[model samples]
Target: MNRPADKPLYAVQDIPGKGKGLVATAKIIKGTRILSEQAAIALPFGLPDKERRKIISQQLKTLNNDARNAFLSLQNRFPTKSQYVGIFNTNSLCIKTSTDEGSFVDQAAIFLIASLINHNCENNAQQSWNNNTRRHNIHALRDIQEGEEITLSYVFSLLDRAGRQALLKKSFNFTCSCRLCSLPIRESQRRDGNVQRVAALDEVAKHQRSTAPLQSLQCYHCVLAYHLSKYGREDCEYAQAHGDVATLLVMYGDLARGRYFAQKAASVFRTLLGSDSNEAAEFAAMARDPSRHPQYGFSMKWKTSVDEIPYGLGSADLENWRWERLIPEGIAPFADIPSKEHFVKGGTSKKRHWCFMGEIVKTKLLHPVQLEVKDSGDKKLALHFYSSNTSDTGNSLRPGQYQKGYTVVILDALQYRFEFGCGINQEDLRMMKIFPLRLAKILALNKEVREFSIRHDDGKRKCHGCGAKAAVASMKRCSLCLSFWYCSKECQTAAWTTKAHKTDCKSLRDPDLRGLFFYNWDEAQDSISFPLQVADDSC
Candidate 1:
């Protein structure tokens, strides 16, 4: 093997349960290169077992005595007549190399010393193929004390404890006793839950390219959160999550946060892969100029300049701005609204609960009642009622209540393509609700909820009556709307009589209106039922 000129940081030693393993001989700091060596023996892929065995034997015969002795000393988990093939199978690292045709091909190579590094679910080191040097490189993922065994994970990240144990036993012929695997049952299960969420978020991110910009951003935010919480900022997956979130943000026209996340991704990539790596270079370019991204300006829904990022905020406030997290302060219980155009048919599983809000523009009673509606974005769509029983449809709304300007909210709304055009088909009466307010007024109220309801660190609420900000826990909320806070009955009376709360209170008191905001729109694991409760306990 072509070893680097520098003295090695680790040495091969006998591990207690594991046969031979690599252990640090000196303290190794995080990001330090532990080893760099050329392969001792390399074999091409896709060849038949017989032919491959013959090739490996011939190659073994050609090696010098020292090299041959080292290769023979490697582990052979699978004993077979072809000893050379057995040694190679037990200790080969997959590397990419150029073939005779000048195209890249995957080759398995045996590294004499590096192969001795054992597996750990919570490894302290990472092994990567450095294509520029044409050598296998191992780096410390965290500080390693002298005499500590340097380890790497053989399986993918975020696997649960049971999954990790099963795969290690089935493939490696060993059971892992890593720190993560040795945790108590309750903590192990909690970690498993987090890992499962990370995996689900990853699955969602894979399809973000085809999803609507807003939906893609939402998925990326969730993915980033899980990665950061489980893996920390230094983990490769956490850096990758930042990069993905940056891309989606730029696609949706949020250049400020996009640039911020891109810079973070670049910094992490530089630390993990060295400053000269292609990944670091690419992200550095993105951080410098996010608008140059191919997806820039696709949707200007959240347009912002690169320098528009906010300053002087606490960590929580900063995170809230970065993720566009919805605060529940003034929000009606189940009032989260999602655009109809973003809903996919069967492909859109419940990532989170969402409702569609639109105003009735026209109504037709065909085989099933059809209502023409206009969304908050001024886009026109149709909602068709398919209930056979009038009690479930017409009886739910008084004759004049279905007239123009009335707002309708449907939970778990989905897009359906019909002969006429694409729209929503309503089948459950419990999922549908109508309010006397206009679509604009309802949206305005939602905006107010977004603004005043969120509690600040100072424990203050923005008074709906006078626009004053103060600690208002002792204050009374408008009893009718349950949508605003007031310091006293006088303020409440004034807000009711003078601030147009009279009309707002009447609209808000409609059980359907209150239900629209009270439903748990963030719970995505199951379908919501009617007679919507104040909170989703499942979440």
Candidate 2:
């Protein structure tokens, strides 16, 4: 493996508008550490400014001639303050340092040569704090060509152009003309929308991590997917997210997936931070024995040993398994289901849920029942139904469900190469349902009810009408759906007329639609049939 060279890979050079910046002197491949140097001066990050200034002044006096000169020469945005203190504040980097097992603290430090690197919204370099080595390491996030200005992101959050500009101006006292920031208005807004959605998903993960583990995992999985599409899983952020998924999986008692994610996290960390990094070594251990995690068995919902991992699964199936992306927490939109060519790659089916849904456009009741359906993507496919082992009559589906514009849903469905056309070969009547509404309308109802439905947390539920929190008995449920809640007759009327609860109430009347909101799809269990037994508390 090509690793960081012993010699410096960059040279401190003067750029046109940006003062002094680190310019790559040699081709730096992604994951190669360009620099790994101990901090010249380190201090706790959030100390009182006066106290920090005094400490910096003291540290300056302790440094030798060359080191002292280097620290003083760095830019001082706050020129009005003491020279050493101002320089420290202007160029300090926040790093994580571990004091003991499973405990870490953030500190501020200054790197003489590293601090000179310029900032960019779309930076090609990444900076990491190596707790084991007690050094700050700069790694190439992407391949860097010789003579390219090696840059790191000063604003790490998914902030838009204006937000990045404001932060850059406030902290670093410079305007960023980076490629992403310099994009046209319409193009920048489009990029910002995508980034903001990722950030929102992260916030959802943080809020639901403890209260709703499955929901939190869904958000993290979406965030990871976004990173994979944008960064191709090579960046530091990707490794951190992978490690987080591993930890969550172990906590949920899914040792099979926990071990897989842990192993991947370790590999990524080894590439970016080296095999010697604390992160790499810790994850490597977890991969070897997932049951050893501190949070293991918090919930045995997904209980399984590492040996339970399915063999011969294709890439898509493994990814679907990793994130639990189908059924329960994540409902696959019709367009996202695998095509026949992609799904027929041959794999051993694992113990997990798979759901496929679409709007019925045509139906055939010949030898085998079949339907032509259109998905959210507006793409059409055929569904050929086979007699299932179960003797149930699909919850006694009415004649309305057989008509055009009705929606059909199948669970644990497998893609098949049919003689007529490519589509799903659905068996198992217990895992399917046909609703009396357009696929688009039913999916919309799912989204709405998911967001506005009252929560069971702490005995207080939010009234979908007036947004007031009250105990269950104190609220009134929409008689049709038994889902939405209200505080008063007036609020209920407003929700029905203005808030458009009328349409939502109609679709949610179908018990299966409501059950989708309450099912624990993340729990590893036997395939279940509808009408799904929903808890009264789910309302």
Candidate 3:
């Protein structure tokens, strides 16, 4: 019956549509702990309804006259007031079930402060049942302006506007007009579809089992996308979603991505829920080393030691690192190569792979300055061209006549700090192509090549020289290129001597050229220009 001595923010007056609610007296920043109190009365679970009623009635009688009268004055939604149990049932929150030990079979606490909080479709506060504390607590998820009613959601899962309205009307005895409740039907449906798809995708990921390390990266991507989208940020769902992603990543061996996700989740939780809360502490531990978790290295595909986190990632890059995927139109050239330092050195060749892609916005043939202009599919790429035709008079292309929207591949690229015409391919014309589309679409084709066409392992290879299926280990590699391996020395000799491997070998040996076969270019980061650089032997 006792209210916190701190003056009530709002007078305990009847809230017209809603039973009785508390309005904020001043703006409350997120993560502010509003109130914490011990329960005045506790009852256990599952006695007969009649017996439970008798117990609550007897307990009420023990309170002082003023406290008893104040307790009885609380609002009731149920139509009938004759039953003492009905009034308690209408106002009391379910604190703990009977399984946990308490005085009564089922324990319910009457929280004077918590019960005053209102419900809203677009709530800025999140309420949690903290079993550790044995009390319900509410934390602000966003800034709550003075005089605004502080509301929390009643439903366990996020409900769409219509679904929320239906549930609220039935259980809470009020219609909600919060921002979510007022969204346009079409926009509302679109956002709802995203939410539903995210849930469905989680189930799909769970149902499909995998034994490899990092095997769940594909599934985690679905949840990651949903949390990053605009709608997910509006609610506390983003933090919870990131926490789920971090947990799954850590279960595998991807401490790099897992730690990044956990840090992100922890940040959000620190904002929506107090930093000292259990959820925040859990994520903080995960952010240190995802692999240190109990489930670390459970799968082999994504295995990484605690020390394997990458170094060069910036703040923005850390975010992209968590997801580690490219948007459909992002410009990324090094998408296919293995990121681990040991793999490139141990597996096959010292050379690392990469490809350059550019959209030909203009073309003009003016001999030595045969200008075939291009774009990096992004404005940030700084689309300027410097000619290295190397002759007084070489063939120039006609403006807008030759392939306009095309990508040109530069082989064995080196950084030329001299000018914009940096990746000077000695044999530029031979490998470059005008694909009649955007650079993004051209990269999509390369993605298909990596996913559907190329074989990754040297142990299992399909020869590009003769189209023969052979184990890479036994095969004799071309002396000049080392890119094409043959079944026998005879096959190798034949490839170089009889087939056109002599020409192909030279092209394949070029590190930039070899990269076209290895990287997962479908996942892009920032804008990539024509002619990607091949990493040095050490990378």
Candidate 4:
């Protein structure tokens, strides 16, 4: 039991069910790099049986007395008698599937220090491959308290109590008894349901092609956005999430969204796994310049430069930026539709973004059957006039229509009772509305409204310090204020000196400010006012 001077930080001791494990000496802060050691013995990936034996045998010959003793002390859970096999079984960790292509085999050089760290279905540390250093690194994903075992997850997905037990028995060979794995049957069932839902979403998210009930960006967000509020585990899963999204976007030929999601994934992985990790490095490179990607310029549908990130949007707005769902399409923007409103009570489905936009091809009037005859897709639909639009000719509406184009906003496609009567069928009035303009003309007018009414730019790049629209790629915003960019030294100087951007810049650079630019406010449940502070930048 000879432990190092960092005594209270960690000590080698027997762990119940999981052999000799390292117990926390003192509280370990999340994101703190725990240890970094050179590999004592290393070999090329996927060696033949004879070659693997030769490599391990050669490495054993070079070990000093102390190193040999350390190697001998690891827990060997395997039913093997050979010391060589025992050490290999005891000191091994999962070789990443991404880096080491094959089955879930163990890396032989995983040190005693690394191997002594135990497993928990819900772990406090994240382990990742740092390809640059050809070493593995562990960072505290959440704070680990003193006297607690520093644990990491062996499997990728968040499993339920039953799922976790099964995986442990089949793969890592242990029955978990962690707090999360030991809830009461009912409570455990609820937690398991949540885990299963999250896992199901993750699986659907990763392999969307194979999953049924296919979803779009809007649909995925509708289902998974609630997970942020529901699970702490999802916070660590952002990298995987962004990667899945990036993959989906790429397949759809939307490089703009693909690049954005890839960049976001890269950022999250870099934070959790370190920038040198393959996931971080690959994504970071993709984010830097999307054109370099093999699929770049594959389609011009959603084209935008990487530096086109907005200057002053709120958190939800920034999320829209990251997702590329803010762009206009045939349907209403995803940000404009609320998921709760899309589904009825007891899980009945309501039409999403279904609104009637038609032109008045003809008009007929008769008491009750008073139809404002209109052209809906070149077919005449009976729009029984029901509004209290009091007129001199109350029931005698004419053939010459009052307007050429008319618009209608319909809520749930429900039929209601008609109080005013003229023998008009209530169903006819139920599906129709008259808002004076055709759908095509309405959309044109909407574009003009966006153009002339709003004083802001088209969410393009401008010097943060000065109100100058600089070239997108060449501008860099002040890191602190983030609200403004500078084209060059002169512009940055002007911002810092003459414009008083120094103060404004600092205020705008706040994470809350950044968060504002990230969150979507159009279909928001809660009103997000100005001076938005950053809550957490997980998105």
Write model 3 residue lDDT over 1-539, tens digit each, in one string.
11122654444445767777877777776676655555544566555668767787788787778767766776666555345555555556555433445432336666666666677656777765455565566677677788888787766445566677787676555677777767888988988877676677566656553442232444555565566567665345668767766666767666776787788888877766566566778889888867667876666445556566667756554444444422221233322212221121222122222344556555443333233444453532222233456472332233443465655554322222223533332234433433444667546544433432355554366654456776656555556654555666666667567755565555556555455555444433233333444343211
The reply for model 4, stretches above 4 Å from the true place, is 1-9, 13-17, 40-58, 80-83, 96-109, 203-227, 232-236, 250-260, 320-338, 341-539
Residue-level error in angstroms, candidate 4, position 149: 2.6
lDDT of 4 by residue, 1-539 (tens): 11113434667789877778877778877566665555666555566646766777788778898877777776666554466654664456665433455344345565658778888767887776554576667777778898888888776546677777887776545677877778789988977766676667565655543332134454455334544544444444757667666655555455666777787788777667766677777887776666677655444545555566566756655564554442222223212322332222221121122233335544465454344433334544444554454463433334343454544433222222234421123232333334444656545533432332222445445553456664556766566544455678788887678866565455444453344333333332332223333343222
In the order shown, the candidates' Cα RMSDs to the true structure are 14.5, 14.9, 11.6, 18.6
Which candidate, 1 or 4, would have the higher TM-score against the true structure?
1
Q: Judged by TM-score relative to the true structure, which candidate is superior, 2 or 3?
A: 2
Candidate with top TM-score is 2
For model 4, what is the C-alpha lDDT against the true structure? 0.55
Q: Which runs of model 1 end up more than 4 angstroms from their true locations?
A: 1-5, 44-47, 96-106, 230-233, 310-314, 325-539
Candidate 2 ranges with C-alpha deviation above 4 Å? 1-4, 98-103, 231-233, 328-539
Model 2, global lDDT = 0.76
Q: Work out how many backbone clashes candidate 2 has.
A: 1
- The lDDT for every candidate, in the order shown, is 0.71, 0.76, 0.55, 0.55
Top lDDT: which candidate number? Answer: 2
